[model samples]
Target: MASKLGVSIVAVLATSVGVMLALALGLISLSIAAGIFLVLLVAMLVFHGAAMDFTSGLSDSEAFQKAVEEKEQREAEHEEWEKEYWGEHHPDYQGEEHH
Candidate 1:
């Protein structure tokens, strides 16, 4: 959304201004400022992608929906496996409903 993009832009500008001020005041060395800027830039890029993807709505995409279903299926399978393993290894183990 436009609002999310605006927020991301404002955050980047604020960070840049803060870093520049710190460099100008000699509170931090040029190398440190550059390193901080680069790290922030990388983080922004990574998070921007995630923000955009989430804002755009993954439910609109069939592939994303399929992936979600697959994940749920896998988790259910894992739960079944755990139930079986615990039942076989523990004499006093009861089903989940008993808990």
Candidate 2:
């Protein structure tokens, strides 16, 4: 989804420029070029904003690694707790191993 948006943003920018130049050079009628240019310009703006938001949310390597490690640790702890609770409450749940 992100890649597609990025590609469309690039395409919009290129098309807008091309259309504007085409109109300026009198190679195409202004009315048709204007509509296409305006649409692409808006798309380019929206995608550019989205790209900025995506980039802003990115973290550095150490931070990302720490986040992943913490997530894994939390998951393991949760699984352990679930096993303890389920072992007492539903020991015969599919013949799970427990005291």
Residue 84 error for model 1, in Å?
A: 24
Position 84, candidate 2: lDDT: 76
* Best-performing candidate as measured by lDDT: 1
TM-score of 2: 0.47
Model 2, runs deviating above 4 Å: 1-18, 60-63, 90-99
TM-score of each: 0.52, 0.47
Report the C-alpha lDDT of model 1 over 1-99, residue by residue, as the tens digit.
Answer: 678778888988999999999999999999999999999889888988888777776555776788889999999998888778888887577656433
What's the distance in Å from true for residue 46, model 1?
0.4
Q: What is the C-alpha lDDT of each candidate?
A: 0.84, 0.78
Specify the poorest-scoring 10-residue window by lDDT in model 1.
90-99
